[model samples]
Target: MGEATHGLIDGARHAFVSPGVHWLALLLLCSAYLQGAFDKLRDFGGAVAEMRRFGLAPAAPWAVAVIGLELAASGLILSGWHRWLGALMLAAFTVAANFMAGRFWTAPKAQRGPMTNTFFEHWGLAGGFMLVAWHDLGGHLGV
Candidate 1:
């Protein structure tokens, strides 16, 4: 590689392997859910409406459940208490929500690009959660 490219790669490697990087990464991963939880709490009515738009009936209850799960997952993962369980919860939630809300294949052609991007983005987040679970499990139960 060129000298500049090599330097950039080395810098990235350094950052990736830094001490406490795992903790930082986990925190960053949990940030989105944390923020969402706060937003739902702050604007509960809006959240319920959004859930209703997604065809989730009993919008109020579903909204509450979603916020509760987000909070629980954030707490567990951030506290490192049963982190694997938290990761799994978040991962499963992400997968389900992505498929439910991101239906790119069913969207109009003009909207497919953004919808597909969002769908894949959610999956990427799910993969991050899985990685967190695997790391936290430390090969326990074969992860």
Candidate 2:
């Protein structure tokens, strides 16, 4: 590569290896869960409605469970204590939720496309969590 291109690549490599990068990436991964938890807390009625729409019985209880899990798991991850366990918890949650909510095959034809995309995106998030778990187990948890 040209000298400037090589320097750019080197900088990026260094940047990615920094603790800041790890912290930022972990925050990004947990951002959705944190936001969801906050929003549910702010509008518990809406959360209950969402649970009901998803056919979960005792919608209020389900909403509370979801909020608690999201907050607890994401906190474990961000705090870097039992990070692997937190990561696995979120991974399992992501898979279960994808199955429960991303049933694209049953969706209307017009909506199936978006639903399918969401399904795969959730799977990707699960995979990211798995990788985070692996990284933590290896004792290289930068966070």
Candidate 3:
């Protein structure tokens, strides 16, 4: 690449590596969990209904557990304290939730397409959480 091209690449890399940007990226990744937890807390009855819809027995307890996990895990992640643990918790949660909620394989043909997309999209997020955990565990490339 030309010098100017290299310079542009370097600049972009620097911007991406900034601490503030790193925090923002993590915040973006955990935003959904945070929002969901808060929403569940705000509407406890609705949360229990959701748990029942997902076929979780003793729906109220499941709802409470999910709300607690989401908040605690996301908090640990954002705070960068035991972040690896947080990432792993979120990763496992994502996969479990995906299976329970994103049953695209059994969907009607017309609904299959969108459901499949959402299902895979969530898998991708779970993978991202795994990567975050890996990096937090000192598996990152020299950055």
Candidate 4:
């Protein structure tokens, strides 16, 4: 390799290892993400029932599917298995969850009470996962 190319590679190696930032960031992200996944899993049945109660029975299957996807994605991310792909999937799910929460916030007052609280919690969890996805992507791209 040319001198400049060698230097560039060395710099990346240094960045990837010296500060230990990559692993630390991934650890934080994965930890937070896995926690959210577990939380959602614990309430998956409730989530489906809540959707049905809201007259979104047609979406119950979808809700279940999403929960499955989230669990799978969390597993992949935590294991660093095809990490880039996992991060992308997780990020997409995060965005979709945020959008889905908005619908709950606009429901009738009685329905909105619990949903409003859940929406905010989802919002925060999604934001944290997004950060994890971002950092994971950055590390994979060597940026």
Per TM-score, the best of the predicted structures is 3
Model 3 residue runs over 4 Å out of place are none
Q: Candidate 1 residues 27-91, lDDT tens each?
A: 89999999999999999999999899999999999999999999999889988899999999999
Best by lDDT: 2
Model 3 C-alpha lDDT versus the unseen true structure: 0.94
User: What TM-score, computed on C-alpha atoms, does each candidate reach?
Assistant: 0.83, 0.89, 0.95, 0.51
Model 4 gets an lDDT of 0.68
Could you tell me which residue pairs clash in candidate 3?
none
Per TM-score, what order, best first?
3, 2, 1, 4
TM-score of 4: 0.51
lDDT comparing candidate 1 with the true structure: 0.93
User: How many clashing residue pairs are found in candidate 1?
Assistant: 0
Give residue 6's error in model 1 in angstroms.
15
Please, what are the lDDT tens digits per residue for candidate 2 over residues 88-119? 99999999999999999999999999999999
- Which prediction has more favorable TM-score, 1 or 4? 1
Identify the runs in model 1 with alpha carbons over 4 angstroms from their true place.
1-19, 140-143
lDDT of each: 0.93, 0.95, 0.94, 0.68
- Let me know the TM-score candidate 2 reaches against the reference structure: 0.89
Stronger candidate by lDDT (3 vs 4): 3
Lowest lDDT sum, 10 consecutive residues, model 3, at 134-143
